[model samples]
Target: MTYLASPSTLFGRLINRTQYADLPWSNILAINFLRGRLNRLSANLPNLIEELSDENLQSAWKVLQPLYYDLYMLRAIQESKQIVQPGETLTREEALRLLHFP
Candidate 1:
């Protein structure tokens, strides 16, 4: 019987051999592309919030909370030199303000 190696072990071995410079440009390009899409989504969020029903508003907030957090982290990572400022992180209240829900 053949035993398969754990995926994490394989992934770790692969990562050990890889350098940041060896990464593909397509991966960087995709991240930049996603950043732009997130920007557009954030710009339109206020208007989108206005169109939701009471029940759906809660659902929208639930969905947006994580998305906004991820966007904030991505922006912070892109802008900061591996040290993100405390102010760069988004609070729940700040997120609601940005969405124009309050």
Candidate 2:
């Protein structure tokens, strides 16, 4: 007998659709860092959509991990009283707090 995987699990569909090459190198590194951390935490962890729905996992990611600037950019843009450049750099501690993981 032969079996076929579900459409969701199809080999071609597993290719990452995001154009990582179009992102800045810093953003790419940040994404890779988060992916590595999550994989190290659980080899069989579900895809991002499912994982994000788990409150405990979300809390763990928020409170127990280092922050990445890419993840903090949105809020900084929304709340900042001054215009900040996308390429601006913050001190490590400041960046961590801005990302809300410090």
Candidate 3:
């Protein structure tokens, strides 16, 4: 038989693990960063789609390939609890590297 933890149980475990009061603030900042990227993409993608030129395609690829890796990172975050070393903190550049940002 297979066993699966419910979402609330998983969330509870996460809540229990975190001891920082600033975690929510960090989460909000991350969400805003992603939201800004998404907004820019929404604003720009239509122009690329309508134009369909070589330069525009290249531009779109440059903008999107990192986003593709970021999506993978999001999945990894959901499924893996081993992304970071124990008690080791990541710098902003290191985080960008994990996203495969160019």
Candidate 4:
């Protein structure tokens, strides 16, 4: 039997083994790839929904996949350190108060 770790764990292992210097991905290419993939996936969703039966196991599997991918992308962004998560948000007044605190 094969045991699979959570997506975050998988990503951690992958990044640790991967050499960023050898990566072919750039911001522009990544943006374009995501845009193209989103458009294609959006167009296909209706067809996919139509082809799958609600009572079938595949229907529930399809439902979980999108949620998993969303969580995966969010985790990637948070791990990158370039983006902030919602819990990190500070009110404008709170921010100014912190800046001026003696």
lDDT of 3 at 102: 50
Error of 2 at 10 (Å): 12
lDDT of each: 0.60, 0.52, 0.59, 0.59
List, residue by residue over 1-102, the lDDT tens digit for candidate 2: 111222233222222327555767777677566656554544344454364657876776676444444435644655563766666768888888989974
Top TM-score: which candidate number? 1
TM-score per prediction, in order, is 0.41, 0.25, 0.29, 0.32
* lDDT value, residue 42 of candidate 4: 60
lDDT of candidate 4 at residue 53, scale 0 to 100: 69
Per-residue lDDT of 46 in model 1: 67
Q: Could you tell which candidate, 1 or 2, scores higher by lDDT?
A: 1
Task: Give candidate 4 misplaced runs (Cα > 4 Å).
Answer: 1-25, 57-102
Candidate 2 clashing pairs?
none
lDDT of 3 at 8: 34
Q: Once superposed on the true structure, which residue ranges of model 3 sit more than 4 Å away at CA?
A: 1-51, 81-102
What is the RMSD, in Å, between candidate 1 and the native fold over all Cα?
A: 17.7
In the range 1-102, model 1's lDDT, one tens digit per residue, is: 111323233233222213556768777566556666665676676687778898988876787778667866765666685687778778998898989965
In candidate 2 the C-alpha lDDT for residue 15 amounts to 24
